[model samples]
Target: MSEHKKGQPNKASPEKTHVENTSGTAQRARLLERLQAGPIDTFTAIRELNIVRPGARINELRGLGHKILTHRLTLTDDQGRTHQGMALYYLSTNAPAQVTA
Candidate 1:
């Protein structure tokens, strides 16, 4: 553990850390599965998959050596509202396998 000022509160509680790690892992797995089946947009991920932050999950998968691509496009939501500069995530066919240490 890194040392902080005497009055500073500890931010990394064991329970919070465990919950965050589990949530991130689950979200990344769900996103990867969805991407494998087909492309998923930000709105779809939020509405359908219950992933509020799809970009973060996608980045986590990329860090694990998955070749994920993003396509920027304008999209319409369920209420007919148009959103500009949206991202659609796709898994590339040439994604490399993860190397074991």
Candidate 2:
């Protein structure tokens, strides 16, 4: 017996939503750590980090004031298939130089 009406979208409980947010936070942390070591491609993020949406994580990092840069290029997958417009994310090394007044 439930009060949920038919044809209505199901909503996640607050606790479940918090868990999903925590998962996203963990994924963002992992992505940041990997980017520190070197550049990370979309395929590598998905295959290794288990992040289905690396771009969203990257955007979150950028929102947090991280200088992440995205480079677009072609990539070859394990199945010998080539993909165009692939994203390669890396931390920007060009910091603003300080000047004496």
Candidate 3:
């Protein structure tokens, strides 16, 4: 059995020493909401949220036990030129159909 002195404070573990950000929590919640609503491409995230590293935020959501999937998209501009991009968001448990941009 461990004994504690009456006037002493217990030591905190290294795991308990980290502080979390309130803004990050809100951001993740919003990000998850957006993902659930529909596919959010990297461009959308950057444009809508003004996030420089949207993928990092998405990874944070993934670490919190959220099931997030990604699809590579190919888009064609008005000039009929094909361009490659990353679609950082689509939420679905079952396998999704092939996506084409």
Candidate that scores best on lDDT = 2
TM-score of each: 0.68, 0.69, 0.58
Tens-place lDDT digits, model 3, residues 18-98: 223225555566567677677777767656655557788789878878878888777654577877975647776533556
- Tell me the deviation in Å of residue 82 in model 2: 0.6
Instruction: Write the number of the candidate with greater lDDT, choosing between 1 and 3.
Output: 1
Worst 10 residues of 3 by lDDT: 13-22
TM-score (C-alpha, index-matched) for candidate 2: 0.69
What's the C-alpha lDDT at position 30 in model 3? 59
Off by over 4 Å in 2: 1-22, 94-101
CA-lDDT, candidates in order: 0.73, 0.75, 0.64
Q: RMSDs, each prediction? A: 9.3, 9.7, 10.6
lDDT (tens digit, per residue) of candidate 1 on 14-49: 323432344665667677777888788899988876
The residue-by-residue lDDT of candidate 2 on 7-96, one tens digit each, is 963433332343234377677777887788878899998888778899998998899899988777799998999999998888886322
- Name the 10 consecutive residues with the lowest summed lDDT in model 2: 92-101
- Model 3 reaches what TM-score against the true structure? 0.58
Instruction: Name every residue pair that clashes in candidate 1.
Output: none
